[model samples]
Each structure stands twice: as C-alpha cells, then as structure tokens.
Target: MHLIITDAWLARSRAIHLSGTRLLLVGVLASVFLMLMTVSVYHWLVVAGAGEGGGRLGRFVLNDEMAQRERFMRENLDAMARKVGEMQARLLQLDSLGERVSGLAGVSAIKAPPPAGQGGALIASRSLTVQELDALLRELNIAAEQRSDWMTMVESRLLDEKIRKSMVPTQLPTATGVLGSPFGWRIDPLTGRSALHTGMDFQAAQGEAIVAAAGGVVVTQEYHAEYGQMLEIDHGNGLVSRYAHASRVWVKKGDLVRRGQKIAEVGTTGRSTGPHLHFEVLVQGVPQNPEKFLVAGRDLPNTRSVATKSP
Candidate 1:
C-alpha cells in the first residue's frame, strides 16, 4: 500500500510506501478503536436512562410478579384457615356430646387436667406460617380421633349398664293382692310352732294372675310337696325368684319371660290354709326378704340370717 502527502504552504508533494503486514495491523487497530468508542457510548446511554422511565418500568414488572405470588399464598392460607375453623367447631360439638353421654350413662364426666400456667404482656402477634398452620390442623385431627374413640367406649359402657338394669327384679309379682305373712320368723299355720318364713305370702282370690317380677328364663316349673305347682325364674347374677302355691302354671322350664308377664294363677294348692301366692327372692340358693326387692322407696335392713335356706 502507498500514501501521498502534500504541504500546501510549501507547494511540495512526498510519497510513502507501506508493506501488506503493516496495512493489516493498521486495519486491526482502527477496528478496535471503533469498537471501544461504540461500547463507551452504549454505557453512557444506559446509565443516563436508569434515572428516567427505564428504571420504573423494570421495577413495575418485578413488583407485579411478586404481587401475584402473594395473592396465591393468601388464597391458600385462607382455605386452610377455614378448614381449621370447621374442625374446631366439630371438636366443640364432640365435647358437648361427650358430656350428654356421660350424663346418660350415670357417670361423671372425665376432664383433662388443667394446663400449666403461662402468660405474657401483649407484645406482637404475627401471621402464622404455612408450616405452623399445617401443624395446627394435624393436632386438631388427632384430638377429633381421640374424642371419637372415647365416645365409643362411653356408649359401650352405657349399653352394658342398661342391660344389667333390665335383669334386676323391680316389678311386683301380683297386681291385685294383699300382703299377708311377712318374710321373717312367724308361727307356722300348719304346725302351730315358731318357724322362719322364707317367702312373703300374698293373699288373693283363687285363679288370680301371678306375674314374674323380672325378665329371666324359667328354671323350675314343677310340683313340690311344700311349694306345690311352683315356678322359679333365674334373673341372672345368681338371683332367682320363686312363685309357689299356684293353681295353674302358664310357663315351663327354659321359657324366656319378661317382667310383669303372667306365669301362674294364685291358689291354695300347697300346704296353705287359703288361696294365696308365695313369692320368694333367693340369692345363690339362700332366701332374701321379698320386701327388700318389692317395697319401693325404702332401704330395708338385712335382718334375715344369711345361712337360712328355704325348706
């Protein structure tokens, strides 16, 4: 490559020569300097624009994205809160039900021990995190399950108690009868001697209805020399009741009978002077006072000997 220089004031011209390698080096340097100028102008324009509209535009976009995330999080938290509230309401209902069941079962309500005392000055209350809310829900669920199990056990106990009470002899044997000879030591009408009467005598007309005192299975339905045409009912728990001196038997052995059900007709079929019904309540084959079971609203004394047996 060649370049020409002219000096106008001196009116002189000169010629210079360059090699190909030097020309290539000059081209590279010129290109590099243009690139440097371009980069400097770009940096100046960016820095100046940052204080104007460009900075606000960038921040607005970032803020909008953050708001979307916050809204999503709030929706999720609200849903969880509603669920927790519902669970708490259900737990309260369960507590109330437990109290009612305890009353029905005739048992005192079992209460949890009081919590340890804790108090502090109101400083600040912060929103719960997701982890905390989840933990609370789990605790509520566990409490509900425990309450359900407790209610089931209470129901079972109540059922058992109801069935047990049904087996107790609380009903009267005869609806229309007058009390005659009481259950204790008395003069034997036939022997004319002092003897223990194991049962109470109910004076009634012949063919009067004689009902069972309790619900049980008939265990004995046959004739005895002393207690003729007798019927015995086993009222569970080693308790039994005997209806003796009946004219006619309406139930047989192994027959299930309900309380107050007619099982015989009163008569003087046994060694009795007149038409009467002999009612006896025996505990494990030993005689107990029939008044102790038949008489209402009174707690009678246990005056009869425990070793005494019905002859």
Candidate 2:
C-alpha cells in the first residue's frame, strides 16, 4: 500500500506518504504537538489578560447569567433584611403591650438591669445585638410570667373581696322590715345611756322571712340569750355576719346559703324590743359599723344594685 501510494503521489507531485505504523506514530506526535500548542496559547492568553478567561465563551451569555444571579441574590437579601426589621418592630410592640397589661394587672415594676454592648444605634436607632435581643426576649418572658402571676393574685383578692362585699347585710331582709335603731353610738332604748350599738335593728312583722345577704356557710344556728334564734354565716376573707332575733331558724351549722335565701323568720326575742332582725358585720371577731360596709358609697352599690364589684 505504501509503495502504491508513494508511486501514485510521485506521479502526482511531492505528495509525501507514510506506511500504516508510521502513520499511526505521526498521528500521535501531531496530536501531542497540537495539544502543546493549545496549552501554550491558553497560558499566553491567560497571562496576558489575567481577569479575562483563556478561551472563554463570548461575554454576552455568561455576563448576562452572572448579572441575573447577582440581581436575584440582592433581591433575596433585601427581602430578608426587611423581614428581620419587621420582626424587630414586632418584638418592640410586644414589649409595649406587655407593659400596659402589666399596669392593668397591678403588677409591680420590674427591676431590669442595664443592657450591655453599648446597645448603640442602627441608622440613628439603637440596634440590638443577637445577645441583647435574646436578653430582651428573656425580660419580656419574665414580664409576661409576672403578669400572669399578678393576674392570679388579683383573682384571689377579687374572690375574697367579692365574698366580703356580699356578706355584709346591706339591705332589709323583709320587704316589710324597716330599721328602727341605726348602728353607732346611741342612747340605749332600755337604759337611756350613750352606748356603742353593735348592730342595726330591723323592725318587722312577726313570721316574716329573714333573708341571707350573701352566699356562705352557716357557722351558727342556735338560740342565744342576747340574740335568740340567731343565724351566723362565715363568708370568707375574715368576715362573719349575724342575723339575730329570728322566730324560726331554717339553716343549721355547715349549711350553705345564698344571698336573699330565707334562713329564718323575724321575731321579738331576747334583747329585741319587738319583732325585728339584729344584723351585724364582724371583722376578725370584732363588730364594726355595719352601715359603713352596707348601703355605702361607690366602693359598694346598694344591696339592690348588684353591679358593684371589688378586687
């Protein structure tokens, strides 16, 4: 084949030719030489223009792709920054609301320590570090916890106050009953001397119903020499109320009674001059002006007006 190709090329002109093996070797050497030339060209280009790529694709497509990716990243970063700012504002709002609620709940002032990290501004506004933000969150949590605690305290106090408010005999038990002697220092009806009056005397017709002023457990339902056919109720909050001079007692010890419940009938018994109810409000076992707590001012409404509340 080489002799035939050489003779054919010699006939045509100076068409050099190789045998099969030499053709293979020359092809390999030519491939190696082309690879080296390519590498040298690449290095020359890269060294001459450092930032510009060696044999890079045209700038149009690659630059457009890079610009779009950068724009997308910038937009995403901007949105994330906005969200962070909104969350920070929300945290501030929560702090304000917590303060207001705490005030209404009668919570004491919190002794918060000073913040660290200079806590200086972000664009003229005090910026909080991650640590400072966490600290603020902790303080808010503590404030919220204290608010709940204060609400619980208020609830307990309100319960007791409501009980006390209800317990005092604020109105006449029987519609027919009217007060004869008021509570205070008064001339004794029998002795005619300035004596401390312990309770109010509600004069009424005999057999008329005597109603309880509040819901409570009956502590005493027995006859007494001074207050015959007496009924005493233990309303919680260190309060006790008595209904005396009852003709017939309907409640006994430990019996639960509600406001306006008929516990007895009016009677002229013991020290009473006629058919009447002797009502008393005792605080810590000592009698006080029942009128001060009953039929009083805005602290409590009239017994007829059940709208007044306490805490």
Candidate 3:
C-alpha cells in the first residue's frame, strides 16, 4: 500500500510507502474505527425508539410490537377473570345446596370454621399478576375439595337416617279395620268402670288378616289370660309393638317379620267385647299412643289403607 499527504504550508508533497507489518497495522486500525461508528449508530437508534425522539423507523416497529403485546396481555387477563367469576358462582351454588341438605337431615346446625378476618382500605384496582392468580386458584381448589367432602358426609348420614326410620314401627297394623275404641280413658266393657285404655281397638270381623306394622323380630307369641293369643314384636331402638286379642297367631317367637306381613287373624278372645285388634306401641317400657303411629303412617302417600273385604 502507498499513502500520500499534502498540506498548504508544506514546501513539497510527502509520500510514504507501507508494506507487510505496517500495512496490516493500518488496516486493523481502520477496521476498529468502523466498528465503533457502527456501534454508536445502533445505540442512537435504540435510544430514539425508547425515548421522546420517536422520529425514526425503529420507533414505529417498537410501537407496533408493544401494542400487540398489550393486547395479548389484556385478552389473557379477561379470560382469566371470566374463569374466576364462574368459580365464584359455583361456590355460591354449593353453599345453597349444603344448607338445604342440612335442614332436611335435621342436623340442627352445621358448624364451619370461621374465616380469618381481614380489613383494608379500598384502593385503586390493578391488573392481576401471575402470583395473585395462582393464589386465587389454590384457594378455590381447596374450597371445592372441602365442599365435596361435606356433601359426601351429608349424603351418607341422610341415607342412614332414612333406613333407620323405615325400620321403626309407624304403619297401620291391619289392612281392613275401623277405629272401634280409641286410646286413653274408656269405660271397661267387662267391669263397666272408667279405666285407662293402653291401646287402640281396631274393629274388624273375625278371620281378618292382621299384619305387622314394621320390620322386627317376634319377641313373644303366646296366649295370655287377659290378652288372648298375643304377639309382641321387638323393633330395634327400644321400640316394640303388641298385637293382642288375636284369633290365631301365625308367627313364632324369634321369627323375623317384615312390615305388612300377615301375622294373625282378628278375633274377640280373652276379655274383649267384639272381634277387634288391640294394637299397642311401647317405647322402652312405657306405652305410647298407638294412634299417633297410625296417623303418622297416614301422612305417607304410599301407606296402605284398611278396606272391607268379603270373607
């Protein structure tokens, strides 16, 4: 390479010759200077796009990209907000269902742990961050799991209670009868004196089938001097039923009997005045009004009514 330098004050033009190492050094320096100029231009363009100097092409590209990013963020946030709203609505529905179940099951009161109280001044709302969304999702998941467990427990308890109630003695003892003598104070037919009637008398003809009111085991099936051929069923939970003054007994002691099963025939045996069934319900060792059980049975739409039949 050859280089020439000239100046107005110089007496004559100066010439310099470069070769090998010197030429290589000058080429490296020129390369470095060009690199520095390129870096400076790039930095200036970046600053113009980011700052108030928005006159360059870089500013337009950057604005378009930023607008797209903002739209994407807003759309995502709106979608998440809709999902959160749906979850909240579901939670409200679960609460209402829980309350109804509790009332029907006679749970008295459902006890839930009190939520921790929080107090804060209302502030300007902002977009939710990922961390906030994660926290909300975790809370909703925990609540849903808790509600599911509660519903399962309520269903189990309600089922058990329904089954147990069905086993209790609360049905008419005969399918064909009329109330002859009600429970409570009545003049004795034999003695002709005021006496406390321990049971209700169902007036029916002889040879009429008598059925068990509820499911139980026959605890006693024997003849009594005052009760005639009497039968007693031991329903569980300290409840029992006695069918007295029967013409004949069909079930034996220790025999399991289901509700509405034919157990005996109606007759006036022992100290009765006419053919009737003396039905009694006992709780523990005390006698309860048998009519109450029959009335309760009547409230059920499926209860079988007593009808007159031809012998």
Candidate 4:
C-alpha cells in the first residue's frame, strides 16, 4: 500500500510505502474494532432494556407455559385421589353386606385384619402421588373380588342344605291321631302269636285325611294282601314311606307329592282290625322305626306299651 502527502505553501510532496505484512495487520485491526463496537451496542440494547421491563416478554411467555403444565398435572392427581376415596367407601359397604348374608346362610365369615390406627398433629396436608393412589386402588379391587367369591360359595352351600332337608321324611302323616300300636316286636292280633311289627299305627277317626311324610314320587298305589289300600312314596337316597290301611287313595303311581299333602283317608281295608293309619318308613327295602322320624318337631305323648289287637 502507498499514501501521498502534499504541502501547498512549501510546494513539496512526500511518498510513503507499506509492505504486505503491514497491510494485512491494518485490515485485522479494523475488523477487531468493528466487532467490539457491535458487541457494545448489543449489550446496551438487551441487558439495559431488561432492567426497564421491555425485555421481559420472553420470560413471561415461558412462565405461562410452565404454569399451564403444572395445573393440568394437579387436576389429574386430584381426580385420581377422589376415585380412590370412592373405591374405599364401596369396599366398606361390601364388607357389611357380606357379613349379613353370611349370618343368613348360617355360616361364619372370614374377617380381614383391622387397619392400623393412624393419628398425628396436623402439620401439613399434601396431595397423594400417582404411585400411592394406584396402590390403594389395586388393594381395594382384590378385597372386593375375594368377598364376592366367598358370598357365592356360601349361597351354594345354603341351597344344597335346603334341598337335602326337604327330601327327608320328617313330617307326620296324619293331622289328628294318637299312637295306637307302636313299632317293634308284638303279638299278632289275629294269630295270637309273637311277631315283629314293622310300622307304627296311628288311631284316628274313619275318613280322616292322611298326608305324605316327605316330598317324593308315588311308586306304589295298590291293594296288598297284608296292607290293603297301600301307597308307597319313594324319596331320594333310597328312602321310602308306606301308608297302609287307607280307605281311599288320592295319588297314583308316578304322581309327584309334597310333604304334608293329603293323599289318603284312614280305614281298615286289609288285615287291620280297626280304622287306623299304619305308617312305615324303609331304607333300601329295610324297615325302620317310624317313631324315630315322626317324633321330630312334635309334642306327641309317649307310646304306651299296652299291646292292642290290630294289624
């Protein structure tokens, strides 16, 4: 590079010369000065303006976005907490219901352990975390399911027991009567010889109604050589009841009958010597003492040992 200087009054001129290295150094210095000025102006515009609230626009926008996100999260947590509380209340109701049903079913219910006591000074109250709420919900669900299953089992057991009791011969066959000839060994009325009497005789008026001892299907309804005008009911489990010396038969073979239903009238149709109902209970064709079953739920007088001349 070269620069020329002229003096007007002295009429003299001077020339100055520069090398490549010096010219390059001058260019670098000018670039550095421009960069410094640019940096100073930017600092005055941004940093100084922030102190006067004009530069706070970006900060305000960022804070608003963060606040919205926090609000959404808090709302969801509150909803979850409320749900957990509802589930807990429902579980308590279920527990109470189960206990009542268990009592009606005549069974003991398995109880859960009581919760631990909780008490503290009210220092602070904080919202539950997602993890804590989820745990509570899971526990309540399991408890509810277990209680439901237990109640179902109890119901099934109760139903089965009821059916079994209905099939047993526990009802008296006659409405009004006194025990005439008791079951067991006795003298035959006609032959005057020792014999084994297989049934109990109930002394009632002629045309008195005779009901069934239990619920069953009538299997035999015909006249017999010894037990004339007889009707046999076949209960389940190979148990049967026979009513002998009936005056009139109301049910026939294959007809279903319920306990305490009228089926015949009392009379001496066969080898009986008087109008009396001869009721007999049998298991697999083996005769059982009718007194054992008839005595239940009744306030009948004790059978007298005095022998009577009857079938």
> Against the true structure, whose lDDT is highest?
4
Per-residue C-alpha lDDT of model 2 across residues 172-249, encoded as one tens digit per residue:
455544667777899987898999889877767899898886668999888899888898898777788899989899
lDDT of 1 by residue, 63-172 (tens): 89899999899888988787798978877776777788888887666465566999989999755689989899888877877777787788888889756755666566
lDDT of each: 0.81, 0.71, 0.82, 0.83
Model 4 agreement with the true structure over 181-208: per-residue lDDT tens digits: 8899999999999999999988888999
TM-score of 2: 0.48
State the displacement of the C-alpha of residue 206, model 1, in Å, after optimal TM-score superposition.
3.5
Please rank every candidate by TM-score, starting with the best.
4, 1, 3, 2
Pairs that collide, model 4:
none
Looking at candidate 3, what is the lDDT of residue 12?
Answer: 71
Give the winner by TM-score. 4
Q: How big is the positional error of residue 117 in model 1, measured in Å on the Cα after superposition?
A: 5.6
The number of residue pairs in model 3 that clash at the backbone is 1
Candidate 3 clashes between residue pairs 3 or more apart in a chain or in different chains: 175-306
* lDDT value, residue 288 of candidate 3: 91
Better of 1 and 2 by lDDT: 1
